[model samples]
Target: MTGHHLAVGAVLRRGKDILLISDPPDWALPGGSVEPGEPLLTKVTQETGFTSVLPERLLWVARYPAAGVEYEMLGFEVTGVGPHDGSGSWVPLPEAVDRLGRMWFAPIRDPAVAYLTGRARVATLWTWTDLNEAPVTHPHVAPA
Candidate 1:
């Protein structure tokens, strides 16, 4: 079993809806695990393919009741959109399940998503951050 976990997510707001994953067995806001020492910017871009990916601070933390996992998650707000190199289009929160298949591990819902989404419910996209050697808080990642 896994112990404490850490990750970064977006409190993404496109119009009124926030990005989320609805696929069952596990549902959540679109986010992923943060490997030690990785820059949040590169991770989100690789996971969500949102060329506009920028890392930010605060947002909030999350604690799951099921496995009792706690994570200090960073949240970014995507401000623009661009073509995905060879991947796919950015999916809306509602269509997450139909568009992308479910993730392998448990999907985490960051407190930031719900807070920003203004709903008690939110879903997430699955991904894992690469190893990080650089400290977090890049000039492009800090809250603006």
Candidate 2:
């Protein structure tokens, strides 16, 4: 809970397939640490190699403590770009969900996926004091 690591990730969709890094039985979104003052979308593009303009929306924010550090993940929804030289495969949503469920990081969960697929409302934001603890969800409200 002392150290803070902030990262950004994106779910790039094309037709019925979503872009994902091939991690054997698991998969990962295109993202990495937010370098000093680096834009999240830029980081995503650098990781995924998608250069065309796409609609990007902030979808979720997750906070969890792991390996004696606090980790914050920002997830986004975006339209897919043309093929790139990245190391990943485009898979259908169902397959993407299965792989994300098995990822080493805390599962991105179905609700988040649903949001990305435009099948559900934006998910409640979540925070956890420890990786092994249950997350606390907060509803979003606009300021008056």
Candidate 3:
């Protein structure tokens, strides 16, 4: 019951498969904390044994259906996995979600994924719609 937001993460893999931290009935990504001066994405990769540079962070979803706390989760596309990592499995998006609470794999159906599909922030990575906005500040990378 400490201040926390429902964060989620994904380790995007080949064949469009993903590494999921699953449960049952609801799947979630690998993420936590929204502290100011922290590089959220790097922390996920470092802690989870994934690559330091995630492919992308696709969403910033906010959920505050509680009291005295605010949670802002940033969802990302993790790239590679290291050997001896605890879990490295291919989980389809749908199955990852359906198995939520039953297991703790990477999440495949975090609602934030749907919410950020058309966001300009993510589009910058895929479509490169706004290169002018490059060097635009980042939590880890300063605008240069």
Off by over 4 Å in 1: 1-5, 21-24, 63-70, 85-113, 117-144
Error in Å for residue 61 of model 1: 2.2
Q: Rank by TM-score, descending?
A: 2, 3, 1
Better candidate by lDDT, 1 or 2 = 2
Query: Per-residue lDDT tens digits of candidate 2, residues 25-136?
Result: 5678877688767765776777677774264667778877778887778788876577776646888988887677667656355335545545444544767776566556
Worst 10 residues of 1 by lDDT: 131-140
TM-score of each: 0.47, 0.76, 0.51
Best by lDDT: 2
Arranged by lDDT with the best first, the candidates are 2, 1, 3
| Per-residue lDDT value at 2 in model 2 | 69
Off by over 4 Å in 3: 1-8, 22-27, 81-88, 100-144
Error of 1 at 122 (Å): 16
Q: By TM-score, who's the top model here?
A: 2
- For model 3, how does the per-residue alpha-carbon lDDT over 89-126 read when each residue is reduced to its tens digit? 55675564344434422122223343223212442211
Candidate number with the higher TM-score (1 or 2): 2
